[model samples]
Target chain A: MKYCFGVDIGGTTVKMGLFQIDGVLLEKWEIPSHTENEGAAILPDVAASIEELCEKKKIAKDQIEGVGIGVPAPVTEVGIVQNTANLGWGYKEVKKEMEELTGLKVRLGNDANVAALGEMWLGAGKGEKNIVMVTLGTGVGGGVILEGHPLVGTNGAGGEIGHICVNETETETCGCGKKGCLEQYASATGIARLAALRLEKDAKSSLLRSQEHVDAKAVFDALKAQDEIAEEIVEEFGKYLGHALANIAVVVDPAVIVIGGGVSKAGEILLDYIVKNYRANAFFANQDVQFKLAELGNDAGICGAAKLILD
Target chain B: MKYCFGVDIGGTTVKMGLFQIDGVLLEKWEIPSHTENEGAAILPDVAASIEELCEKKKIAKDQIEGVGIGVPAPVTEVGIVQNTANLGWGYKEVKKEMEELTGLKVRLGNDANVAALGEMWLGAGKGEKNIVMVTLGTGVGGGVILEGHPLVGTNGAGGEIGHICVNETETETCGCGKKGCLEQYASATGIARLAALRLEKDAKSSLLRSQEHVDAKAVFDALKAQDEIAEEIVEEFGKYLGHALANIAVVVDPAVIVIGGGVSKAGEILLDYIVKNYRANAFFANQDVQFKLAELGNDAGICGAAKLILD
Candidate 1:
């Protein structure tokens, strides 16, 4: 049986998985990311880890297909990364270096994009080729898959859904230095910001006012108890997210929208509000788009990274 | 030299073209569309014309590549058109029928999409493979081409840019049974509607008030003459179109946006207002997207239809 390695490189950890050609995971492990010295050791470390794993498993080099990597930065189709601030790398030739170090073919994709591919392959979007996956983490991330391939545009900027301007009139700036980005209203932090804004707007209180640190988890927990203020905050968050997805549907018309990330831990309850707003704003022809929760969670990165080589 | 046939079936006429495999238009002509009898005669007519041309030119079947068709309706990847209200067709197997009739390989695409492809091949987006083309005619129609292929969605609803909800708070309903659609403000008729609304909001002394019919042309002509009310209407139009495009860019990250259709007759002046608002609301990474006017006018359909076969 042929084998392949999937690697997800984040700021702190390098997650790796060995999988059968047909997608069955044989083993998975991690290594701490050595990002000092411009992340010069990161590729070397990854290559050494793969070599060590192969030696321990007694797998021949010819048995392995290649290595697929998902990086925490925008990656060009050719495997060049312009800026990986999180990984302490600047304009690195990731694919070339990795291939040279391990003498294995390498494929690279953006983390969020590969995660979406994972979902499409074996997670919530399984069996569906066209899907839009939104990750509502500390910051919102998006990955668009069309016909089983990620929609990686000319400059690797496709599926930058978090930066979509949902509210054009807002004065507040987003982390991208843009005003009224979807990330400013629909991310995990954005949800807490909504709760904060709601609390600041009115004295109506019950659960949130009692919390010292209000976050997306707290907001959902409070709403589960039928908190009126939490309800409003969720509604506003749903409007921004759902409306943005509706707009996205107009462009790509994905069969399903998979919601993941930290905020999605709120469970299926989150989809209720989001689906309601999505239907209310979606184009007539696209009103029936299915909404599903991402199932792979953290493992999505590795699985999706593996998919990169298979594709 | 191998030859191909490009047929663009419109509501009133069917424009047919004979092209060399290299994309040179050898000959072109038109035939009246018989939309009566549920448009049953349309495909048969298209086939007969192509067969007659081959016979007249003494071209054998071996010398022909295939035929590409552009229909005025949503088309699935397999070339099934769910509804063609203008052509009086419903639930038609366009590709199968055409292939049977002509005994040649057949390819079908949406008219707007093929027009965008035509522009990409030889018009404004000549060298670009990723492009979003918006046709601002009686209505706003869009075609998104990625890596030189039209993005045909699950149910053929992809690239329906006109129906995106740009203004969620709008009370007036759009033609698509939605409220606040971009088409309500960005189409040619939408521009006239904006002019009407602007004139009605205040008794502003403007050149539009004197016109019997204040259409998009009147608004642009008045703006050129430095009419204040006309400028306001154009600004509103530009805001809707430009902002909607910015949202689209975040989803697909196209290299260029090609503007076409009837309203583009206003020339470079139209690009000014649109570019201004687009820069104001676009994501930081996508602020440099190029905007160009479509170079192929009515012939875009035929050229793009021809390209469908080539692809």
Candidate 2:
């Protein structure tokens, strides 16, 4: 019957959720992220909302297990956030300060790691202890949950799968200033960029040729309508995505791989393409990796953040 | 004050070591592996060795910790060897059989994983909890030690790092029946193969043209002599190796990468090439990975097998 809070801190908003120790999320909400003054009010504001909830519900503080927060920055095992660039944060003792403010134990994890944990707990990768969840949002982000624990690395940067080089001979740089990264070909932006490149190269008699704005969605939509150009674009994207997953399989050998994000809304087709390509490139022993669509979507961050403490 | 035996089961010979609980090796030896009759004599042979050791040393049965064996096969968490193709084993209850035979506790691990653990315990990667050990022997092989423990996956095939696909366009198949695996580019055989390819393409005045057999050693010796074609061959090998390490870095984010196996005899030059390429392609945050040569050499297997019991 104990309760706990899972907080997902972002650049613009902080996603929060209340959950039972048994894995049921009872409530959820969001608070505007105050990055002003170097995010000075962010922690205090979160503490205040939690304190108010405690007072209004007449719930004893001890009845709650504590809080688990997922940060956008690299967080150490002791809960020190190195720096959340978007939050203007530069090394905060998150666990210590949060515990002092709320008078409860606090746990911390990276946002992607927490999300992968959340999925392993209640979303697409349920019942699987070894899982890898790839989020194809604006950029590629992922979490590695091995034997049910997020591999928060020596420097807390273990699951940065997006930066893995997929194309070694690239001219352009990635957002991280790397060239030929997986995020360049597998992210939403990457897919859109590929579509744009295709259209620019040779869009002969293609439906995408007429669209004013060509994007990842346009490419998938074209595929649904059986457009040849779209099929080619999707196939290339699949090649990178599939190859990336295959590489990860050798290192982690996860039981399941959950695909999520804005690009994943393309649904089964995306899942099938990635899986097919992954099988072709994966190590023989890891060829049968289970592929699943992320079910929690936006709530994954909150749910996974909470799972930090649950674990 | 307690003693234990570490056994490494190989295709042709079994390496055994005697150790103290405090990580001191007192003695070591080897025995011929009998693959006849479905390898039925393997366990009995191992047990006889341990039993004889105990009696000769006059060590009390209760004073000994147990035996830990590293098998050349996938070993489940519960110590079951699914099969050792070379050993003619098919799903042997390794732990139970060993325990019953020696009248002591027993544990099991994959040979590569055990070697990695051994290296972490007392070799090149000492004091580092997160480590990835790459073995470039006849074929590429490896073991991942995360958070100071072997990551024995659900199917005990977790550390199959060699078979990870590095070249998606590879038309030739690897020994594992896969195409363009890291093993095909980084192993001793792979390096020799690359040298042959380079020699065939253009070896106008190369020193390798003098040697009747251009092996991995010949290539490295040529590199030391500053041969042009050899340098090109090494560069291509470095490119694939560097890319593979960069890819593995994001997954494990280990503090150190230890290079071992027959090909590693090239020493600093080999380490330098892999590290140079690794840094170029690594994720920005994980660019400071420490690269070291495994110090244990041929003894890694026996030491690692013994270390498994310590864990």
Candidate 3:
């Protein structure tokens, strides 16, 4: 069976996975992402590790298809990484540099977009050609796959759902310099922010006041036990995210919306809440969109990255 | 040059356009629509028009590429128009029927979606593959083209941007049985509603109080003449439409947004207001999306419908 490599570049670590061309992931590993001096060592480090793996396995280079990579940046249509903020990259022609080093074909994709492909391929969105995925971690990450193709927009910023304005009247600004973004209300950090706001509003009857770290997990746990304040916090979060998603549905009209990332572990409870709000806000014809939790977990980025080359 | 026919099926009329395969409009005409019996006469009427045109022009059937049609309905991938409400059509095999009747191939599309294709090909979004078109007439109609292809959702309900919820607390219901839909605030009727509310709220100081019919055009005229009440009403309309569009941009990230329909006749005055609000609400990368008036006007549907056959 032909082999291929999938590389996922993050701010802290670079993840690498080995897979058969038909999509059997055989092994995976990671290495430190060297962002010093404009990330000069990042690609070189990835190249070296890949070469070492090929040598150790005695796998002929001819037997491998190519490499697929996911980066934390808006990728232009021609394979230029517009900006990998975390990797300290700026307009890097990754496809060319990587191919020249490895002497193999290379495919480039935005990390969140690649993970979305992974989920569609092997996780919650499997079997669906049109789907939207929102990774609700510290911040929200989004990727829309339309007609079995990742929507790499004009500036490779097509599926940036996190910044969709949910509330225009807000005092605080989002990390992306936007105000009242969906990310400010629907993410893991956003949930905790809501939890804090609720605690401050009703300090006398709040369950979250006792927790040292009032994180999303604590809020959900409290809600599972039927805490009033926790319930309200989760409800508000769901309303913002669900409504934003409904608005998104009006554009692509995906068959499913996959919920993933650190906060999605809230699982069915979270799904149920988001679905409730989604129904109320969605266009009449698109109100029946399926909601599913991502199944591939942490392996999504690597798997999706691999798909770039395979596709 | 080869020839093709474009047909637009609407509630009151069926517009027909003859175009060269090289993207030139050769001739055009229209016929009264007969929706008297479940739209049974619609396709037959369309067939007659094409047959008569072929005979009049002495154009052989083999010299024509195919007929492209746009109907006010959700058309499934396989060519079944799910529902043509205005035409009284329900789940009709339009493509098959038209092909059989004409003895030539046929392509089908939703009206709004076809107009979007038209705008992309030869109207406002010309030369751009990704675009979103909003037609703000008595109601709002929307279509999204991604990678130059119209996004027809699972139920053929894709690109239904009019119904995206901009406010959840609204008590009044929209025609689609929803509350706070963008359609309720962004359509020509919606603009009139806003104008009425403004007149009521500021009865003592409104110029619209003197007008017999406070339609969208009247409101824009007052705004053009620097009426304070008119300005407020327009701003409110812009906010709703702009914010909703920003939410849409988070998904498709189009290069341009084309505004069409009767309301768009307000032209640059309306375009500037919407663009201002859109820039404020859109994702940063998408904030730069160009705004333009739909150039094809009444011909967009016919022109875009023809694209279905050529594409």
Candidate 4:
């Protein structure tokens, strides 16, 4: 049986997994990324971890067809991480360096793109040929899978959906210095921020009584209680999400759209509103597309990385 | 020499052209399209025109390898035009009907998509594989070319950039019944509306003196006279255009972006501002993509339809 290794290199942790060509996960593990270290310092530790896993599993080196790495950075088509704002790395040939260390063929892709690939390959979009996955965590991130392959553009920066402009009135400032980016309103932080602003306006909500510091979960709880302000915020959030998805539908027309991340934990409450508004706002002809919740949760990274080689 | 016939079917007219394998135009003609007539009624006139062209050029029918038609409507992958808004046709098999009339192979595509194909094959996007072409006419229309082919989604609704939501606050209404779409600010009518709104604010500008009624060209002319309000309007217009393009750049990261249509005639004065703002607003890694003015002008429709077979 052919096997491959998939590594998802995040800012703080690196998730690694072993899998067969059919996408069954055999084993998985994690390691501290220590991303602060220079390029040379990080490779030896990564190599050591891989070698330890191979020995413990009694897996032959020849059985491993190739390794696929998902880095939290913008990569060139040829596998160089051009620049990662979170990691502070610039123009690093990650694939070549990892290949040298592990003595195996390696391919690298952006983290969002890889996660999207993972969802398409083994998760909610198992049989889908076209899918768009949005992760609404601390920040908004997305990946586009078109025709059963990741839509990696000229420089591998193609699927940066968070940066897409969601507002034109210059209301909120994004980390990238742009105002009114989608990430400013749709991510976990954005939702919490909206809740806080509502609180400042003296909007009555059950959320303030239970939690000293409000978060996205608090907002969800308040929504369930039918807090007028929380419901309004949720509605607005859903509208933006639906509007963005509708536009994306025009560009990609994917068969399925999977929503993941901390805010997505609200489940049907969030999805119901998104679907209601998406159908109403989408171009008249595209009201029939499907929207679903991503099933893999956090394991999406490892599974996606593993599936890269198979794809 | 091998040749192919490209027909661009519009509401009022049909533009036809013959193209050689080397992407050169061999012959071209146009005919009135009384689209109110049934699809069957329009067939013989198109056939007669093609026969007359062949006779005039002394070219044998066998020399034409195939015929490609670009219709102003949503098309399925199988060449059926599904309810074109302008043509008022419902579920018509354009390729099959044209093939029966002309006794040749036929391929059908959306008009905007075919125009992008034309630009990719023989215009500004020559030699580039990934491109996005936006036509800023009365309403915004877009085409996306990825990996050298027009990206026609499953429902054939891909490349609908005009409908992408650029505003979250819902300040403007779009013709598509959406709020704050990119078309509300970037298209010819959108610019004229902006200029008229500025005039209402009692802003001082030569644009007021340039024309009896405000239009996109009048705004450009006023900007040339260094009118403060016109320059500000142009600047604001540029920002919106830049914001939309930046979002598009993040999603597709095309090698080149071709801007066409009536508003594009504003030339460098408009392009310089858009390019500068786009660079500032784009995701950090995608700063190197090129933006160019489309060169094919009005011939894009026929040429694009022609190049579909060659591509």
Task: Identify the candidate with maximal TM-score.
Answer: 1
Per-residue lDDT of candidate 1, residues A1-311 (tens digit)? 99999999999999999999898999999999999998888999999999999999999999999999999888987899999878899999999999999999899999999999989988999999999999999999999999899999877888999999989788889999988899998999999998999999978866999999999999999999999999999999999999999999988999999999999999999999999999988887788899999999999999999999998
What lDDT tens digits, residue by residue, belong to model 3 across residues A1-311? 89989999999999999999888999999999999999999999999999999999888899989999999898877788767669888878999999999998899999889999989887888889889999999899999997777988877988899988888677899998889998999998999998888787754676787889999999999999999889999999998998888888877888999999999998799998999999878877788899999999889999998888888
* Model 1 per-residue lDDT tens digits across residues B57-166: 99998888899999999898888998997998989999999999999999999998999999998799998999999999999999999999999888787899999989
lDDT of each: 0.93, 0.89, 0.90, 0.82
Computed on C-alphas against the true complex, the DockQ of each candidate is: 0.84, 0.79, 0.73, 0.57
Query: Model 3 interface RMSD, in angstroms?
Result: 1.1
Position B192, candidate 2: lDDT:
92
Measured with DockQ on alpha carbons, how good is candidate 3?
Answer: 0.73
What are the per-residue Cα lDDT tens digits for candidate 3 across B143-213?
99988999997778889988888887888899999899888889999999988877877456777889899
For each candidate in turn, the TM-score is: 0.99, 0.98, 0.96, 0.87
lDDT of 4 by residue, A86-200 (tens): 6647778888888888998888888898899888888988898788899999999999988777788888777788887776665667898877777888899988887788778
Error of 1 at A14 (Å): 1.0
Q: Is candidate 2 or 3 superior in TM-score?
A: 2
**The candidate that achieves the highest lDDT relative to the unseen native structure:** 1
Q: Give me the displacement of residue A59 in model 4, in angstroms.
A: 6.9
Please write out the lDDT profile of model 2 over residues A205-228, one tens digit for every residue.
898888898889989999999999
Candidate 1: regions farther than 4 A off: none
